[model samples]
Target: MSTAIRPHLSKIVLAPMEGVIDAAMRARLTKLGGYSRCVTEFIRVSDVLLPKRVFMRLCPELAEGGLTASGVPVYVQLLGSNPEALAINAQRAAALGARGVDLNFGCPAKTVNKSMGGSVLLQEPDRVAAIVAGVRDAMPADIPLTVKIRIGYHDDQLLEQIVAGIWSAGASELAIHARTKFDGYKPPAYWATVQDVVHDRARQLYINGEIWTVADSYKAIQQSGCEHLMLGRGALAAPDLANRIANDAVDQPPMAWELLVGEIEEQFLQHDCNSPRHIGNRTKQWLAYLKRHYPEALQLFARLRTLRDVQSIASQFTAHRQQDLSI
Candidate 1:
């Protein structure tokens, strides 16, 4: 691996969550300042080549200079079954100025798995190898290529095959989500399985799944014997998560309503997010977690959830946020 890729092996990376980790969320989390890199939500691939507009939509940060406002590089992830389609899309994203390209094989969403995407691909290591090879061949060498996969589909029956195929296909880094497709989002992420893989494979390893606190992160880091972590839900639950792990507490401020409001406003203004309904949907989803830290925000979230118009929702959101701050 080139020097460009080695540093990534030692740093914490934010997992690419489909709907949850939008540019706004990335911007907010990156501001907390611990992630070495962030992967944008997966770009679903089709048989036909994706238009530039589609790539832009999946990863708006590409046009915003390939990094979130916090100056963190965002790798664009691609999900698909066809090698050609995935490769073409991956290359297109790299050409359009993404920092890197990551393949998603850990998504457990039925909608994705039913289509022979995500963790389902773990059952077909040969196919995974072919797809990875295609994209690696097409993408720039200095631009890192990583793959995220689970331990197995429903079992570890083909775990070795999957890991070998990923390496043969030229995946410079591998992130193991530590559970089967059947496991869903439940507990016991099987960090031992990922630890086993790291012991065997020469590729870099990132442990993911159910790391919701600093204690959990430390345990994962020690258990997996892999320094790198990819936080999915944990970072969402606590915005300062990455900062805590990195031991950089200078900006480790609490998740106040003001910070949340500023992030929402920045996302709305930059994305030209006009639909109050759509904006509320994203804000409300985040509010569910933000509420945990700042319980007072829940009233505003509940009020905003009922309103259909964006204007009313925004007004209510603002009022509630202001009230929370005042209190």
Candidate 2:
């Protein structure tokens, strides 16, 4: 059995991919093992009070040990620049059975950064402190409040200072994305930067960025000497990658085609939409990274995109898979 450095840190956390890591994705990732925790995509924090249904929709697993089907605890992630509003919403989420709260400070979406939310907060360390303080104060003491952040907004000049501010503001832990807001998922995640933070600060560090394979993850752990890691695109690229890391095994991951097809069928089946069009579109988005795992994934996605409707696309996908299996 794998042991975590801290009880809260999962050896593998499915990165919070907006629109891609939905309830269905969460359920599938849970079954794959190796993932210890998962966070929903960032929910917009509005100045106006949100309806209760919104909270339920954001975290359906809260009713059952704050975990998805695979029993991994899922944290509800909130994204906004307003400290007070974010705090209020954090409390509401906790009261509604949320086990933990994750504040988003690293989202690089143009709309989000422009709205003074997500990675934009990195531009103002003091404001980030206030936001963390407010949410930490509002949430229950037992409920851990964590924050995810990039190095800086446009430059890394303030990265160390921002990390300090988050810690001072009562954040229980921090997951560093190992790059600046401007890096925008580009090449080279600056992993060494994260190692510097862990070596210098007393805080627990979870490495995120460019860890696509077991070897990549191992090298990161070796370089940083930090055990905890968070996989964003990596886990999606290979569902069983985490199991390989947790077991310290060198086995290649399971065939990506098998996992992706199964996840697509399972997620679409859960919806009541007149057709699976909406869900099918979601699958295409994930294929951005998933295809790299299985070359055939691109062909499958291309076939999916050609269809005009979800039902037809789904039928084609299923029929093709059945044919492949029979041969």
Candidate 3:
């Protein structure tokens, strides 16, 4: 082992990817082991307080005490610019059994930005602080309130100010996506920039973006100098990445592609059969990510890319699984 010092990495959070990583995916990924927590897709809160049904629908884990079947905490994520509205809905989530609430200030989608909901908020550090402070105060102190943000809006000019404001506003944890909104999921996350500004040892920090393998995680930790990480698309690309990183098995082999495809198929069949038009879209999205790691995933994606029906996709999965069994 190298003698250079490395982060202790006490937590690994499953990043909330909108239209992906829903309740079923959370359950499946957390079940495979080594995740400390999961976050729901951001529930868009506007001027009104959303109903209980909305909360329950986005985060079914609220019905299960804010935990997946595997017992990992699923923090309810809320996105909006209205501090009052955000606070009210956040408290509602807590009252509905959410153990933690995450405020999303990092989404870069044009629709979200135009609505003044996501990274657009980063342009105004005080507004971000107000939203975080308002939500934090409304919720029980015992319930953790976390904030997620990109490094900045168009540049890192306000990075220090933003980080300071969120912490000063009482956010218990801050997860930085490491890229400015202008960068938009591109390469060069500037992981080391986090170490340059955020120096508070009292609060936890999770570094995200461009981490798709064990080697990537290692470099992210060393460069960011942060102890915790948030896995986004990387988690889907390699479903066992959490376990691999947790165990420090840098060279550990990925889960067999056959077994992974089978698990994906089972989840799709169990939780995704209801919506006819959207039957195989989510599975295909996941396969796109998985293809980055497993050649079989690419081949499978090619096979199912043109198919949209549940029956057809399900049949392909059956053949895929039977072939694995025969092997």
Candidate 1 lDDT, 1-327, residue by residue in tens: 111111222478998887789887888889978898999888888686899998888889999779999899999999989888898888889899999999998888888888988888888889989999999998988888999898999898888788888888888888888889899888989887766666655337788888876666667766777668899877876787787767733233455556666665555455435664465576667767767666655776777777666567657656765665663
Evaluate model 2: give its lDDT. 0.78
Error of 3 at 227 (Å): 1.1
Candidate closer to the true structure by TM-score (higher is better), 1 or 3: 3
Best-first order by TM-score:
3, 2, 1
- Kindly report which residue pairs in candidate 1 clash with one another: 276-310
Best by TM-score: 3
lDDT of 1 at 205: 78
Q: Which ten residues in a row have the lowest lDDT in candidate 3?
A: 1-10
Model 3 gets an lDDT of: 0.88
Off by over 4 Å in 3: 1-6, 321-326
Alpha-carbon lDDT, every model = 0.79, 0.78, 0.88
Off by over 4 Å in 2: 1-10, 200-203, 256-260, 271-279, 322-326
**lDDT, candidate 2, residue 182?**
79
